[model samples]
Target: MLIGDVARRSGVSARMLRHYESLGLVRPTGRTEAGYRAYSSEDIRRIFHVESLRSLGLSLREVGRALDDPGFRPSELVADLIRQTRERIAGEMELLTRLRRIGAAGPADWEDVLQTVALLQGLGAESAGRRQRAALSSGEESPVPVEALVEAVLNETDPNVAGALRWALERSGEGGLTLLAEGLGSPTAEVRKRAVQAITEIPSGEATTLLRNALTNPDLVVRRYAALALGARGVADAVPTLIDMIVEGANDVDAADALSALAADPASADEIATGLVGRLAHGTVEPSARRRLTQALADIPGTTASRALADLSHDEDRAVALTATYIRKLRDAR
Candidate 1:
């Protein structure tokens, strides 16, 4: 059978069949004289198994493992799948609980309820009910007081949900700032992170302070995110901290990102490039750091950075040599 025939028989799309093939999940059994790929009945069975496992949310890697294991037990896999599904339900329930608290003041208007109903109808009542059932089974909270029809605007995974929440918080007046600040201090890391992100979107002075404090979080992941948030906020106060991080942090990737962010400001670019040149001239920085610093210098536009790059053109490091080329481009453009 051709790919299309296998797709028809197994109820998987031909594009998905090709993706499975690329992932090494399936292969054509043979090829015709004209070079058309062929598949066997066995391939159809394999496709069915792949599709079934996919429907259970098993990743391609997990499905591949199950397919490769001769003694793989479907019952055991199904049990694990059920466990994962339950965990997901529990998480959704927690989100729903938070959403309910936020939306407890009642719908913004009748249109809100109408929109929620429309969304639920679009998703289909049966499918939405199944999700609610899963949430209930996992002991998660509903987004709204109504357990049966929790408004998803507050609990949705869509990016728009964050924006919507921020708008609601702002419109809530003074209480909204307090609520957002409280959320920032929430024990839940996700809530804290989201709160910070949402606050930054509100264009308040407190938001800048919150992001600055987040940059010093014990968690490197959180710090990186905070750095990114600060950059997005474009707070001039953040530039010094970002430059310090680039100079002192062991996490080169994060440091590089911070440096890139700081370099966006012309004053910051001059300061960092000048400081790097001084460090390189004094032999105070390591070769790798020097190389990174040179790269940073090349990132800044203007005569100062270009001149610094021109001075380092004869450096022994290949990275420094490459940076000199980049600097030359800047100078040439002038």
Candidate 2:
């Protein structure tokens, strides 16, 4: 077969075949009497082999070595190809994500597009300060897409930067609650905590609903954060978890404060005192936990709390009795 026939049969362009010949990747073994390049059957087979290897991302030089060097080992080269292919795929995926984020931002013009790009780059910057600045400015004039802010908030490790990201996410509105809700289900405890924390900063009713749903999250930390946020918002539903926090001594002081905040409403004071007294009465309640619960009663302002303190003043545990007595005195002095 002549070079033209080989090119027609193999789909390798004649120009590329000549370039391959120049590089010694493939060489036809004979010439026609007319002096046109000619290819033998073995040369056609080699051309097919080169094209096959090139399809696997092999460089022309690598293809030449692979075909010509008897000592060439394919394993190392194949592994290198795999690595390079993976890197290329990763770069493409990252670019796709950036384009999706920019498109989600709904930029009105080229300047808006550039600004969104700069903000995203800043959010992913190596410096925490830059990330914080990016987050703070994200929703100032034109907002970064909510998805980008949520992504940054979920991944941010620095406390200050995380705060800024949460603020940015809050300004993005209820859209962030969905992504942050996904974070709540993360197997990583820190991520779940961050998710709830970011949700707490968003003041929408949807965020509150999400928090109410998170009350049942399997992660204890997530439950506590939800309880704290809900309690501050005067959600009576958080009372049980807040009381549990006191009994378990997990940030019991803050939990106590939250309970007190919930108690500020006249309708909730008795209910809050009742939950506290019920925990104190549990047979397995630790004396230290009992004492903590007694101290927690000082913030509850109703008759139920005053009556519970009077009864606890003579309780079996000296620490509990002493703390209750001091609280009763303070309550009576008022």
Candidate 3:
């Protein structure tokens, strides 16, 4: 068969066959009587072999070594090809993600597109300061897709940058809530904590609903964050968790303040006071927890809290009694 026939049959072009010959990858050892290049059956088979190797991402040089070298081990070369292919795929995937985020931004023009690109780059920058600036300016300058902000927020390790990303996400409105919700379910504890913290700052009804749902999260950290946010929002659902925080001595001070905030309402105040009193009365309540509980009741009004404090003022434990007595004095002064 002539080179043309081989090219037609094997899909390697005639010019490429000659290039392969020049590179010693494939050469026709047979010639037609009229001095045209003639490819024997073996040369044609070699051409197919070269094309097959090239399909596996081998360079022409590698292909020559693979086909001609007796010492060439296919395992190493195949492994190298696999690594190169994976790297190429990773690069393509990164580009695809960037394009998707940019498209989601809905840039109105080329300038908007450029700005969005810049902001996205900044979000991924190695410098924390640059990332923070990008996050701070994301919603104000060019609209970054909420998903990008959420991704940055979830992955951010720097506290300042994370705060800025959370701010940016909050300013982006409830658009990132679904992504944040997904983050809440992450197996990573830090990610779940970050997700809830970000949701805590979004002052939307949907955000509140998410927090309410997060109250049941199995992660204690997530539950605490949700409860604190709910407490600030005056949601009574956080009452149980806040009381638990006090009893467990985790963020007890903030929990007490939250309880006090909830206590501003007469009905919530009564309920909160009752919960505190109940915890204190439990048989398993430790001396320290009892004292903390007694201290928590100082700001709560109504006869229930005052009566609890009055009773606790004379309790058996000295620290509890002293704390209750001091709180009772403060309450009486108020």
Candidate 4:
């Protein structure tokens, strides 16, 4: 076949075929009497082979090496191609996400688009200061998208940056909660904890619901955060974990305060007292734990906590007895 026929048959343009010849990727095997380039069957087959390799992201030069180099191994080259393809896909996806967020901001013009783009870049910057500034600015006229704030909040490790992200998420509204709820199921415990903390700051009913769901999260920290948030919201369901946190001495003071919030509601007071009383009566609770539990009862309004404090006042551990006695005197004074 002549160059034109070869190009027509193989879908390789004549100019490309000539360029391939110049690079020795594929050369015409013969020429006609008018000195036209002509390709034999084998040459046409090589041309198809080059096109096939190029489709796999092979550079034309790589295609040349692949077809002509006897010592060339395909395994490493194929793996490299896979890596490069994944990187390209990741970059494109990142771009798509940025565009979506910018669109989600409801930008009215190119100026809004540019501002959103700058904020998005800031949110992803390596410097914690930049990320923090981005998070803080997220509440301005055209806020950064909630999705980006959630993404930053979940991945942020620097305490200041994380706090700023949470604040920004709170300002973005409840849309960030969906992403945060998904983070609650993340395999990484820290991410799960961050998800709960982020939700805790959201202060919406949806956030409260997510926190209630997270109360059962397997991670202790996640459970504790959820419990504390739910308790503050006067959710009696958090009473159990608050009691557990008291006994475990894990943020026990905060736990006690949350319990106090629950107890502040007359409906939940006796139930809270009863729950605290049960932990105090457990056989294995140490003197220190018992003391902490005794202190936790100070805010309970009903007879259950008062009576539990009365019984604890004469306990064998003098420290527990004195602590309970002090608490009882205070309750009496109240």
Best by lDDT: 3
Ranking according to lDDT, highest score first: 3, 2, 4, 1
Weakest lDDT window of 10 consecutive positions for candidate 2: 138-147
Give TM per candidate. 0.44, 0.95, 0.96, 0.96
Predict model 3's lDDT versus the native: 0.92
Ranking by TM-score: 4, 3, 2, 1
- Write candidate 4's Cα lDDT for 1-334 as tens digits: 8988988888888998989999988888898999999889999888889989999999998998988899999999999999999999999999999999999899999999999999999989999999989888876685898888888889999999999988888877788788888999999988998988889998888888888888877888888889988988989999999999989899999999999989988879999999888988899998788889989999888888888889989998899899989988887887
User: Clash pairs of candidate 1?
Assistant: 93-141, 96-142, 96-143, 100-143
lDDT of 2 by residue, 1-334 (tens): 8877888899989999999989987888888898888898888889889989999999899998998899999999999999999999999999999999999988889999999999999999999999999998876576898888888888899999999888888877788787889999998888899999999988878989999998999999999999999998889999999999999999999999999999999889989999999988899988888999999999999899998999988998888888889987877788
Residue 113's C-alpha lDDT in candidate 3?
88
Residue 197 of model 3 has an lDDT of: 95
Candidate 3 lDDT over residue span 84-171, tens digit each: 8899999999999999999998888999989999999999999999999999997556788898999999999999999989988988
| RMSD values, in order shown | 21.3, 1.5, 1.4, 1.4
For model 4, give the 10-residue run with minimal summed lDDT: 134-143
**Predicted candidate 2, C-alpha RMSD:** 1.5
